[model samples]
Target: MKRGLLFPTTLLLLLLLGTIHAQPTPDPLDGGDYAQVYARAQAGGDAVTASRAAAAMTEYRAGGRDWTARAVQAARQATTTRPGDPDAQLALGSALGLQARAGGYTLGALNTAQQARAALDRALSLAPDRPDIQAVLAEWHAGAWAKAGIFSGGNQDRARTLATAAARRAPDTLFVQAHAGIALSLIHDSQARATLTRAATLNADTPLERDLQTQAKRVLEGLKP
Candidate 1:
């Protein structure tokens, strides 16, 4: 199958590389502004945003490590305020994945990945072509299945297929390109370079995307037996 790059974007590596996004200070609630909460969470190290960012950090690790519980609580708050907000659900799912990762055990991680997949699937069902949702899902799938046993749900073949789909879902998205590269790299095939190149070409304006691109390049350079 066709493959793509899977390097970390500059911003994502900076935040997620350490296993989570750094957070700013928590801000006063502006009457349920989930978007503001999400944005603040990205700033990192701020007192107001720190709480939320910490939570994200927890979830990204997919375990009880970091602030997994706290992240889940915060995500709950976001979803509570905006019942149908797909982003809120996505946050909740991602956080849950972190909790699962911390939980360790292959089975537990698989279960958590399954939950995340369900949540992402729901979000996609609501908006089938959403680039952000697709990109995130692609990454989630890659990570979840990377080490999974074939007997379990962690098939590299499936991961490659999903990553390719993610690339098409958001060709211009840095996350999509980065994840695609990673998936290809895992396949241990000759096409990884081209896929990694595609990820490198993605222009990531945000710190998250930038980090992904940078990581992608590193992964490309590191490709070997």
Candidate 2:
């Protein structure tokens, strides 16, 4: 009886182990989970979730054109579904900016940049206290100023003012610090190095924050002594 009980127990343990081993590991992309989130957001009329899904797709799908397109679509849906949601408008602007960056400084890119500016302006109007959005708007102005021409409206002075405001509003946030530092660097501001150094030294809690830290470091290295 004892031998028969031991055999059955060992078989049960073996089966448990086999079942555990057969379970698939979770994928980082989670088999395109962003799509499901976006779908759910749409079905539930949830602007926040839609924006989150759009932003996640932009970050996770990085260099893929299809991913960027989908991100733009989701962001647009979010903004349209909740016209008063500042976060949704911000997401839409950010997605459009990403697409513009991917396209470089072509006419299409300039056009997209203008649209991004419009969306960002709307977000700012809705939530003027958000430092992150201010930083992005500053960066947009700075980038446009750097590549300004007949087709693009870019004002360096406006960029400087916006960057200064963002820095003042959120001195501790890496996003504000890094972007403001970069914008200041473009005009050869004396404080750019210190701001970028602070940004680089800050601990990053997310992939986006890490990217901002990396950018700060690169900009700091490029500054003249």
For every model shown, what is its TM-score relative to the native structure? 0.62, 0.72
Task: Give the lDDT of residue 205 in candidate 2.
Answer: 62
Q: Candidate 2: deviation at residue 152, Å? A: 1.6
lDDT of 1 at 117: 73
Give the root-mean-square deviation of each candidate in angstroms: 14.9, 11.1
Which sections of candidate 1 miss by over 4 Å? 1-52, 55-64, 155-158, 187-191
Cα shift from native, residue 157, model 1 (Å): 4.6
lDDT of 1 by residue, 1-225 (tens): 123333445556666655643565333332233335545654542322433454534423232354666666666676666657786777777677666666667676667767767777777777776766665665566566555545435456666666777777667767667767776676564656777888898676555455557779898989984
Model 2: residues with Cα > 4 Å off, grouped in runs: 1-62, 149-151, 206-208
Top lDDT hit: 2
